[model samples]
Target: MKITSAVVSVVLLVSAQNSFGQFPAEEVSRFAIKDFTFESGQAFPTAVVAYATRGRLNAAKSNAVLLPSPYAADLHGYDAFIGPGRALDPQRHFLILTGMFANGQSSSPSNTPAPHGGPDFPRVTIRDNVRAAHELVTQQLGITKMTAVVGYSMGAQQAYQWAVSYPDMVESIAVICGNAKQYPFGVIRLEGSIAALKADSAWNNGRYTQPPVKGLRAFAIHYAAWSQSPVSWPRDMLDSMSNQQVDQFLRSLEAPALGMDANNVLSQAETWKRHNIGDSPGYNGDVEAALRAIKARVLLMPCRSDLYFPVADAEYEATFLQNGELAVIESSAGHAAGGGADSQAIRFIDGKLKGMLQ
Candidate 1:
C-alpha cells in the first residue's frame, strides 16, 4: 500500500448540550432457530442474535437501517455519529444495532450453555450473520425492506454482505474502510495474531473460564500496530495513551473481556479468512458480474491513509457495481479515521446517505 501525506489540523469542538428529545436503546424481540447449524457444522438447539434500535418505524416501515457491530467492538462504537441531525439521525430513520455472533454479549462461546461455552462453539460466517440480520428484520421487527445499510470496517463488511445476500431487501449500502474480500496479507496477519493468543501458556488450551488476560493483552498490542498508519501514528500518541491510568482502555484494543473465550476469536477470524464472495464454491466466475448483480445503490468511503482496506479496493468495487460511487476522505487518520468518527467521513456520509434517501 502506498502512503500519502494527508495531514490536516483537527479543531475539536464540544457542542453545547441540548434538550433534544432522547432516543434510548431498546431490545428487539429474540428468537431461536433450531435447525440453523453454523458453517463449522456444530449442532445446536438455537442461534440467538441480539440487537438494539433507536427511533420509530414509518407507517410503510421503509426507512429502516441495519447497523451491525464491527469486529470485537460493540454497538456503542458508532454512538457518536447517531442523533437528531447526524448521518444516522433517529428522527429521520429507524436504526437497528445488531451484534455479531462472536461478540460475547450475544451468541458466542463465552455465553453459550455449558459444553458449547468454550472451544466447542460453532464457527459462523459473514453469510450466516447477514441471514440472521435478515431474519431479525423480517421475523422480529416486521420490517420488509431497509432504506439503507451503513457501517465501517467489520460492520461495513456486514453491510456489503447484506446487499449481496438479499438484494431486494436493501435499497442502498454505504460501506466505509472495508472490502468485499479479506486481503491475503490481512488473512495472514489475523491468523498469526490468533495463534499468538493460543500459544500463550495463560490460554490454558482455551479451558480457562476466566480468559487469558496476558495472551489477550499481547494480541491487542500486536493489533494496535496494524490498526493505524505507521507514518501518521506518532510515538507521542502512544506515549500519551500509555500514561493513562486505565489499563482496560489500553487493553480494550488488545484483549477480550473476562469469560469472553478465545475460541470465539479464532472462529470469527477463520470466517473472515475465508471471506470471499467467490468462496461459495463453483461460483468462480467474473468478479464484476457478481458485483453488477447487486441491485442496491452503493457508496464506498475510504480514508486516504487507511492501511487495511486501501482506497483502490473501494474504487474497484465502485467501478463494478451498477450504481456505485467512491467518496474518499482526505485525512491522515488512516484506518482509524474511517471509523474514528472524523469530520470528513461524517460530512461525506451525511450528504451521501441523504442523497440515497432522496
Candidate 2:
C-alpha cells in the first residue's frame, strides 16, 4: 500500500523531534578548571565550563570569534548566526560559544555537588564569566587573540566586559541590544523577576522540595511582556493566541526556567545588578573612562524599539569608544531584534559584522 500523506506528515514530525533530541550529543564540549576562584573572592574546588565551537581555527589562531551565550540560553543558543552562509560565517570565522556560569550547562547551582548545589552556589559576577572565557581561549584552546567578540543581550554585556577587561586580547567586538552598564531599569526588571520567584512559598529559601509553579508562572508572564515590543505584539509574538493559548504560551517559555534553582537565577541577577565596566580597576566606577579604555574596533547595534537597553544608551556609549561606530537596528523586535529575529535585522547585522570581519 502506498503511504498516506497523513503518515508522511507524522514521519516528518518524528524526524524533527529526533534531530532536536540529538542536539546535546552533537554540540556540547566541556573544559574543566581546577579550583576555580570567582571574582567575588569565593572559590570552588573544581568546575567545568560548557561550550560549543564551529568553523576551523586558522593556522595563525586568529580566526576565532568568542560568542558568549545570553541569559538562560545554552551554548547552542547562537545557532541562528553560526553556519556556512550566516553572519558568523563559519567558512571564515571560528566561533567559540561559551555558556554563562550559572546557566546549568556550566557549573550552575543545579549541576554542582550537594554542599554548594542549591542555595550554596557562590555569587558569580560578569567579570567571572569573562574570566572563564579567557581561560577557555588562552589555556584550553591555546590562543592568544580573537578576531572578534560577538554577543547579544547578556552576552552583549559580556562582550563589553571582555573588551574592557582585556583590551589587548580582542581585535573587534559587536555588542547588540545591551549596554556597557546595568541601567536602573535593567536592575528594576531583574529585581521584579527575582521577587516573583521568591514570592512562591515553595521557594523555601531556595531549598524547596518541589518547583515553585505559581511564582514561576507569574514571573514568565512578566518576562514575556518585556521581551518584545507592544507594537509588535498583535502581529508578531502571541499574534493569534486565544485567551487559553496565551496561558499555554507563557507556560512553555517558563518551563525551562522552572527546572533551574531559584538561587541560580538570583546569582545571575546579582551579577547583572553589578555589571559596569567602570567597576574595573582603571576606571574606578567611571563608565566613560571604561568606554574610552577600549582600543579595539567596535560595532554597536542598538535596536530603536528596545525598551530594555534603549538606543540612546548605545548612542551615548559610542561617543566614548575610540574606534566605535553605532548601527541602529530599525526593527520592532525590541531587544530581540538585535538577536537577529527578523530578516531585516539579520541583514543589517550581517552587513556590519562582515565589514568588521574584513
Candidate 3:
C-alpha cells in the first residue's frame, strides 16, 4: 500500500482499536535478555523483548533508526511512518521497532508466571525499557550507533531517555507529543485512570480469574475524556454523531480496553508515571543538566492542544537542550495529533521528521 493509504488505515485503527495493524511474519522477531536487571534492582532470569525490523542494515551499520512503541502498543505502533516514500522509508533506513515491557508482546505482568507475575511484578521505570532496547541494539542486532530515535507519547519519553542514557549511541531524536518528565498533572491524570480500573469489584486487586470488564470500561472512559481536546468533542464528535452514534462511539473505546489485561495496562501506566530524564544516573536529579548533556540533534514536536504533553512544556525543554529545535504541531487532535490522527497532522509531522532525519 502507498504511504498515505497506510497512514489513513493507521489513523482509523488507532481511533477504533487503539492499536496498529499486524505486519508480515518476516518482519517480526524477538530478542532475549539473560538475567536482565531492572532499575528497581529486580532481576528476571530471562526477559524477552519482541521487535520488528524493516529494510537492510548497511555495511557500516550507521543507517539504523530506532522506533520504540508507545504505551499499550506493539512494534507496529509506528506503521504510519514506515512505508516507502515516508519519513521512515525502510529502503533507506534500517528500522528497529521495539515493543515496550508490559505491552503483552514483551515481558509483562499478565504474561509472566507466579512470583513475579500480576501485582507482584516489580516496578519498572522508563530507564529500564531504554536499557533493554540498548541491549537489543548492541548485543542482538549488532549495531553500534543509531542514526535517530523517533517516538510518540510514551515512545517519545523513551527516545528522550535514549539520548540521555547513552549520549554517544543516538545521533538525533524526535520527541513527538511526549515530555522528559511525567509532570504533576500527568501523574494525577494517570492515577485517576488507575483508580477507576481498580474500583471494579471483579478486579480483586489484580488476582481476578476473569478480566475486569467493568473496571476496564471505566478506565477507558476516564482516558477518553483527557485524550482529546475539549474543542474536538463538539467540533469533531458531537457535530458528527447522533445521540445513538455517540453511545456507539463510546462503546468502541471500551472494547479495546476490555480486551486488555488490567495488570498489563497498569504496568505501562506506572512506567509512564516514573519517567524523568533528571533521575538518570549522574544527573543529580537536575532535569536541565540532563537535557544539556544530550549530544543528539533534538526535535521537539508537541501538539498545540495536547493535554498529555503540552507545547509549553516542550518550549521550556527546548531551552535546555544543547542542539534542539522546537516544532509545535498545530492541531486540535490533542495527543493523537503526533500519532497520525488526521491527514493534515500526519503530513505536518512527517515533514518535520523527514527534515530531522536528513
Candidate 4:
C-alpha cells in the first residue's frame, strides 16, 4: 500500500479541461431481466437497470468504464465530470453510467407496477447492483471486462463490490469518499433519517397521497448538518451565503427531494446501511478477506474532512488491498469533496482519475 496527499489547489491550471469535459447529453438506455432474485431471497419480476453511455468502445471493447450513481443521484448528476477532456474522458474511453436500482430511473418503488410498487419494492444489495451491472456490460454492451469502475460516495461502495464480485471482469477501480462496510455510527445517522420520515403523520405507512413535506424538510436539515463538516459552515458556506440564505437553502433541498418517493430513499438507505463487500459469496462476511480478494488495481480517494467516510477509513482499507494507493483530498467540503462540486477537491479527484486511466 502507498499513501499520498493533495493539499494544493490547481483550479487555474485545470480550467481548460474542466470546461471541455462538461458533456451535456444524458441519454438513458434500459436493460431488463426476468425473475431478478435478490440476496435477501426476495425476487422481483422483470427487474430493469437503466444506464447511459458516452464515448465509443475501443476496437477491442476493452476501454469500458462503469460509473454507478450515488445516493439520490441519477445519471445526469455527473454532467460536470463526464466530458471529452474531463476525468472520465469520453473521447478516450467507453463510459457506462450505471444507475443504482432504486434511483427512480431503474426498477424503483415509484416506477414499478402495483403490489411490488411503492413500499413493496424488493430489497437490493450492493452485490445485486454489481450482478446486474455485470450482465449489462457483458450481455448488452458486449464488454468483456472494464478498464476501471469509477464512483463517488454510495457509488464508491458499488465500485468496491464490483471489484470483489467479479474480480476478473474489472482491471481497476476508483472509490471516493466511501467505506468497505457501513460503520455502526453511520447506520445510526441513517436511522435518524428513517425515524424522521416515519414520524410524519402524512406518511400513512409509506402509502401517503401527498409528499411528507414536514418529514422531508426535517431529513434535509439533518443532511445539511451531518453531510458537511463542522468547519464548512463558517469557512466555506458563510463565505458565499448569508446566515438567513443558508437557512433557506437547506430548507429548499427538501422540495425536490419530496418529488421522489420516500420508499426509494429508504431502499437506498437499506443498501448503504449494510454495505460490506465481504458479506457476499466466498468472503462470508469477513471484511479483511474480501479486501484481499479484490484483484483490481485500487485507487482509494478519501475526503480528509468527510464525517461519514473519512480519510482514516481509506488508510485502513488500503492496507488490505492487493495493490492500492490512498490519495487524500484535503478539504472541509465533507463527503462531497470529490464529485466536482467544489474546486479544491475536484482538481485533486480529476487529477487522480486521469492518472488511474493512464
lDDT-based ranking, best first? 3, 4, 2, 1
Clashing pairs in 2: none
Itemize residue pairs with steric clashes in candidate 3: none
lDDT (10s digit) by residue, model 4, range 1-358: 1111221111211221122113343467889988989888887888898888989989899889888988867775465577778878889989998888888788888789888988888888988998998888898888888899998888899999988888888988999888898888889998998888778898888898988878777765565556656766543434556777756654554544555567787788888998998898888789889999889999999988888786777898999999999998898767656665467777788888899999
Better of 2 and 3 by TM-score: 3
RMSD of each: 6.2, 5.8, 3.7, 6.5
TM-score of each prediction = 0.84, 0.89, 0.93, 0.89
Give model 1's TM-score versus the native structure. 0.84
lDDT of 1: 0.69
Superior candidate under lDDT, 1 versus 2: 2
Output the lDDT of residue 60, model 1. 91
Candidate 2 per-residue C-alpha lDDT over 1-358 given as tens digits, one digit per residue, 9 for 90 to 100? 2233322322222222112113466678889898899877888888778888888899999899999977766665566566777669888888898888787678988789878788888888888899888998999999999889999888999999999889899999999888899988888988888898789999888887887777766665565567666665544434556767766654555554454556666667778887898888878899999999899888999888887889888999999999998999998767666654566877888888888888
Q: By TM-score, who's the top model here?
A: 3
Q: Judged by lDDT against the true structure, how good is candidate 4? A: 0.77
Identify the superior model by lDDT, candidate 1 or candidate 3.
3
